[model samples]
Target: MAAADSEQIRRRYDRLAPWFDSLEGILEGLLFRRLRKKLWSQASGGHILEVGVGTGKNFAFYPDGARITGIDFSPKMLEQAQRKRQRKQIAVDLAQMDVQALDYADNSFDTVIASFVFCSVPKPRRGLKELYRVCKPGGQVLLLEHVLSSNRFMDFMMNLLNPLVVKTLGANINRETLKNVQACPFRNVYTDPASSDMIKLIRAIK
Candidate 1:
């Protein structure tokens, strides 16, 4: 669940939500859409849970006929996602929920997915544990995230900018999320660099 800083994050995202779709659209169109498409297309038909589903950006990328439940802690962000869902006629159950403590029972979902979310989580490992707990045995967990770069210059730049970035955007630019995922209780962990080793597409099994 959210910690003491969660209210700050919520306020930040709530403030950002009004214009976030347009800004994210421009950004994703320029940089992230292709990788997101590739990653989301791999999703098979099943009961899917998407955590931190900001503006429902992945709604169009999911395979047709797949059941989806999308959750986010930010209600304002979820409102945008709901609008997009209506516009696209995408069938999804949207909820305002925290990731660290999922409301669902154990082994409830066939697949769990998140995109660019862990960097903003106040308690990432706890959130990851929840994902593991809700996912049925043999189900998959997929994530698309930006992490600290392997390149010295890029890593240094990200580190230098991280505090301000987190303050302003509620997202850390230098998170070692893939490493965190590897350390979690998941099996068959696989990672592919999605952008010059800065962004990664990760797949693991519960």
Candidate 2:
């Protein structure tokens, strides 16, 4: 993906930062919170890295004693996350960083996590490769992502609407994230349906 595209996404997210939580509040209350908990529960809680930690929606779910570092490309989004962190007194290191170009050293984290993030990343495969790079040899990669549906009609609709969705929300509605994860160096990849077949709980070993 081009640098311009990545910067565009960052700008879009920064613009959305103030309204993001309220915009997704209903869905979060009804479903996302449960999925977040399930995803966090799988964490080994040792030197974790969370990619695209937007507005710190997962802050409440961080495991006890987990050494966490959360990164995002949008500074405004990180600001929202920081406020939440302070209010909750969560122990997390927050940074402005891109998943596709992580600054961490090789084999740096015990667990790497990304939730609802790949769809917005300009280069999903590149981001996944970075996750594989930063994670320890035996560490885990946990993801909660929504993907293109297997149903032909739904897939077609998603493809049709994806451009508009991305333009307005800075997130693509039709990403093939599970396949992207498989294409990376990670091993023992596994997926389970978190909400129908479209939304998946993907787990892989690094």
Candidate 3:
């Protein structure tokens, strides 16, 4: 991603921070909440790194004994997450960091996770590689994402509307996330349908 594009996304998310949760409240109640619980249940715990931990929505589902570090590129988003962390008494270290260029050492974490995040990353493959790099050799990488549909008509519609969605929401609704994951070095990569064919729960072994 270019510096300008990245900055634009950061600014957009910062502006959306305050109303982020409310904006997706209906979707959260109807679908995302259940998917999040399923995603967290697969966590190996120990040292965990959660990328794009927007507003800390996944904080409540974190398993006991997990030492979690959450990062996001937007400071305002992190601020919202911090407030949630405090209100819920969740033990997590929040930081402002970009997933495309993580600041951690190689093999720094036992598990790496993300939820509905890859579509917004300007360079999704680079971010996945960073996730692969920071995770231990035998560690787990779990993700919850919405991807381009297999249906040709729906795929065409998503591609057609993707630009408008990106312009307004800073997220692409038509990402080929499963293919991107396959391009990474992670082993045992697989995915399961989450809410629908468009949403997926991805699992990979690093």
Candidate 4:
């Protein structure tokens, strides 16, 4: 995708920042939080980076004392995340950065994470490559995402809805993320369905 399109997506998210926390709260309660907690709780130690860390929703789920850096493309979202971090007294480094072009050095983090993020990335593979680049050798990447379904009926529905969804929210509802992960350089990829094969939790070693 072009840089201009990516910027537009960022702006959309920034505009949504004010209501995102509340909106996501209801969505999380429906199912997202359970999977988020399950995946995030596995980062036992070492420096961790969360891509698309909107409002730091998974912040509290990370193990205590873990060194964490959270980045998002949306400044307004990052501001809300900062407020949450301060209010909850969570120690973390927060920055406004794009996942597709991370600023961090190679092999800088022991673990990389992203949740419900790839669907909105203008270039998902590029973003995944960046995730792979920043992760240390032998480190792991954890992701919780909703992807294109294997079920033809559901897949058709998601595909049918994707354009409208993307136009409105800048999030595609039919991303084939597990396939993308398999295509990336990361090894030992594993995925399990979290919600009827629509949402998934993915793990990979770098």
How many residue pairs collide in each prediction? 0, 0, 0, 0
Candidate 3 local lDDT, 1-206, one digit each (tens): 57788899999999999999999999999999999999999998589999999999999888888899999999999999999989989999999999999999999999999999999999999999999999999998999999999999999999999999999999999999889999998878978644478999999998
RMSD of each: 1.5, 1.0, 1.0, 1.2
| TM-scores, all models, native as reference | 0.94, 0.97, 0.98, 0.96
Clashing pairs in 2: none
Model 3 CA deviation exceeding 4 Å by range: 193-195
1 against 2, candidate with superior lDDT: 2
lDDT of 2 at 186: 78
Any idea what lDDT model 2 has?
0.92
Worst window of 10 by summed lDDT in candidate 2: 187-196
| Tens digits of per-residue lDDT for model 2, 56-100 | 999988989879999999999999999999998999999999998
TM-score of candidate 1 on Cα atoms, chains taken together: 0.94
Indicate the residue-level lDDT of 67 in model 3. Answer: 91
The residue pairs in collision within model 4 are none
Ranking by lDDT: 3, 2, 4, 1
